[model samples]
Target: MPSLKDLRKRINSVKKTRQITSAMRMVAAAKLRRSQSDIIAARPYAIKTNEVLVSLVTRTNPDMHPLLRVREPKRGVVVVIASDRGLCGSFNQNLFRKAETFIKQNRDRYEDIQMVLIGKRAGDYFKRKNVAKRAVYTIGTPSYELASEICDDLIKGYVNAEYDELTIIFNEFRSALTQVMHVDRVLPVEPMEAEDDMMNVEYLYEPSEDILLEALLPLSLKVFMYRALLESAASEHGARMTAMESASKNAGEVIGKLEIKYNRARQSAITTELMEVVGGAEALKG
Candidate 1:
């Protein structure tokens, strides 16, 4: 049992911590709302882009463009996206684990496996392991410019034949309390099964199929990257918000428990003092 003074001090400290957690919860909630909206707006654009790409690929020959060329992947790259900060429960850890598992499983197939980490947390983790080929850091918040930069590097790598295949690993936003880790191939674009269904549709290209494809392919890739970054950002915000809300609730519970302890300790002290006073008066009467 702690002394009344010690209990009071502990109660005060818990109250301070509870205040901080509650504030963080509110802040995270606000951010999550904005992020969720952005993600909702971007989803349709991404889906339409993919549908167009599928239609174009099905109608065109595979040899028409270099991006559509698929060959045995001798070398590969994995781009991992994670948050720079922690305290979001298992958001970063889940992505990292998925990336690591992929590398380990595919080690035998690829002669070289390179990593491009998007966030400080993922970069640091890969760097400590001495496994990353190139890592970009300090992408404060995921934005179009940052995604464009990453897309440029990935395009260069694919064009230069640095890697035959490129994959991206990140968390996809589902809801405030849910995020699903996903690993998707980003380069040497795979032909979709639905492509065949779109092949019969009549369409006209502005210049020609070849020229339009040349321009559209790269832009599509950039858009895809941007969409991924946005999704990941939204997911991160949601995870943080959910985690902080839970923390705030837990903190409230802890404060309640501490307050009860403090009251009990103070009561015990008062009872002890009263007993001493009563006994002393009786002895005086005797």
Candidate 2:
């Protein structure tokens, strides 16, 4: 039973909240657009890189390549890509759930597990587990430099036999309203399942095919990491946009309800004043 003053104040507070939520929705939309465009632009390069790597593998003995080498898992590392800030529904939560599944599934195989978190949310989610080796959290857009830095350490670890398996988990951007969680094996690059139609690719090389592979291996792995970062960034933007839009709609509904309540309270106050005046006049006449 709030008075008129309280009702008015509440209405004003809700209006302010609605304004903030609306603004957040707009900002998220803009960021989502930019992130989607970035993904589109990077698609060609990533595709081309994969095609080239596939062609090279077909021409050479993949067994000789270090990245193609596979062995029994003794230790494993998982790279997790999530958003630094959350206001984004269940994006981070879903990813963490998947990560937990991954860890549980691998626990029987790997003697030890390591975590490399790409965002703050991921780090926080696993902080209590004591598995995180490193975390890179950024406020700005995800960049190639960050991916490269992360992959560098991963590559070094694999080469040094620090870990026998490496994988990455991230949200894959599908559309404005859709995102699919992806778990990609980054080490011992999974063999191309089927032969490409253009398999017989011939490239004249000054160095031997093995030498070329040595150089391309690192580049290819870097591209894979970069692509994951890009996808995660785009997904984050999309989730944030969707979440903000929903919040804005909910706020609108709340404001509507508050408006109704305010009107009722104000009307009740006016009615009370009118009844008091009539009673006073009747009393004076008597």
Candidate 3:
């Protein structure tokens, strides 16, 4: 058991911590709201882009566009999206574990493998690993410019035959409490088979299929990268908010317990003082 002074000090410390956690929770909540809206708005455009790409791929030859050309599994690149800051619970840990598992499992499939890490956390995690990092970027706000820059590099590497496969790993925003991890292939865009009814119908293209594919394939890939960033940003904010809320609750519990302990200690001290005074009075009277 601690003295009254010690317990009181501990309670005060916990109260201060509770205040900080509560503030962090509110900040995270605000950020999450903005990020959630961004991701929600981006989903529709990303989905429509993929739909259009599928339709275009079905109509055009796979070899017509560099993005559509499939090659043997020789070299590969894995793009892992995490976050720059910590205090987001297991948001980055889960992603790192998934990326590690993927690399371990696919070791024999490719002759060479490299990483493209989008976040300081990811870079720090993989720094001591044996894997090579092709590029490492610190992620901030999700923007088309950043996405385009990353997509261009990926496309360049793919077009140059430096890598045969490219895959992206990210957390998809579902709700404030839920996030779904995804591993999606971004390079060598797979062609989907057209339905029989759609196959029979002929549509005219303003430009040739080849020209249309060239314009759409890269744009589609950039859109995908941008959407992934948005999802990750929202997921990070959600995780942080949840973690801070839990921390605040735990701090409150600790403060409550400490206060109880302090009250008991103070009462004990008072009782001991009262007993001493009563004994002294009895002696004097006697």
Candidate 4:
């Protein structure tokens, strides 16, 4: 049993903590709203781009483009996206675990496996393990410039044949309370399924299909990378919001329990004092 004074102090401390968690919850909620909206707005554009890419790939020959060529992945790179901060429950841990599992499972197949970490948490984790090949540490919440910079590095690696294959690991935003980790192939663009009635459609290329593909392929890759970053930003906010809400609720419960304990302890102290006084008066009368 804790003393009444100690219990009171604990109650006060818990109240302060609850207030902080509640404030964080509200902030995360506000950020989540904006991030969710951005993700929603970007989805249609990403989907349409993929659809166009699918149509184009079906029409073009694999031999005509370098991107469409499928070769054995002797060397590969994995881009792991995680949050810079770690107050969001298991978001960073889950992503790191998934990335680690992926690396372990594929270690035997690739001669060289390199890591390109996008977030501070991921980079730090890999750096501690001495496993990351290269890391990009400065990505803001939702910046196009940051996305473009990462895309440029990844493109350079692929174009130079430094890696025959590239994969991206990220948390996909499903809902406010749900984020699913996914691994997406980022390079050596796979040929998409052909649509029916391909000859009926006419594509007028100004500088031939080869030139169009040369331009579109890199742009398409950048768009995909941007979409991934946006999704990750939204997911991070969602995770933080949910975690802070849970923390606030837990803090409230603890405060309630502490209040009950304080009241009981105070009552016990009062009862003991009353009994001591009555016994002393009786003894004097005797």
Q: CA lDDT, every prediction?
A: 0.81, 0.83, 0.89, 0.82
How do the residues 107-214 of candidate 2 rate in per-residue lDDT, one tens digit apiece?
Answer: 899999888887888877777875646445553568778777888888888888888999899999998689999998879788774365665646787587788778
* Model 4 lDDT, full chain set: 0.82
State which candidate has the highest lDDT: 3
- Number of the candidate with higher lDDT, 2 or 4: 2
Where does candidate 4 stray beyond 4 Å? Answer: 197-201
- Model 1 segments beyond 4 Å from truth? 193-204
Pairwise lDDT winner, candidates 1 and 3: 3
State the local distance difference test value for candidate 3.
0.89
Task: Give the C-alpha miss distance for residue 251 in model 2, angstroms.
Answer: 0.6
Candidate 3 lDDT by residue in tens digits, 1-286: 7777788788888889989988988998999999978877887888777766677788777887887889997999999999999999999999999999999999999988999999899999999999999999988888879999998999999999999999999999888788999999878887777656543446688778778879889999899899999999999999998999999999989888887788888889999999999999999999
1-286, model 1: which lDDT tens digit per residue?
A: 9887887788788778878877877787788888878877877877887777767666677577778788689999998888877778889988888998999999999988998888778877777785847656556877878888888888877888878998999888888889988899967876656643454668877687777677778778888888778778888888888888788788788888988988888888899999999999999999
Highest TM-score against the true fold, candidate:
2
The alpha-carbon deviation from the true structure for residue 199 of candidate 1, after best TM-score superposition, in angstroms, is 9.8
lDDT of each residue in 1-286, candidate 4, tens digit only? 8888899999999999989988988988898889878877877877777666666666677567766666689998999888887788888899999998998988998888889888888777878775747656646675666777877787777777778898999998898799999899867887767667544568686777667777778778878778788888888888988999899999999999999998999999999999999999999999
Error of model 2, residue 111, in angstroms: 1.1
Regions of candidate 3 where Cα sits further than 4 Å from its true position: 195-207
Residue ranges of candidate 2 with Cα displaced over 4 Å: 132-139, 193-196, 199-201
Q: Rank by TM-score, descending?
A: 2, 4, 3, 1
**TM-score of candidate 1 relative to the true fold:** 0.91
TM-score of each model, paired residue for residue: 0.91, 0.94, 0.92, 0.93
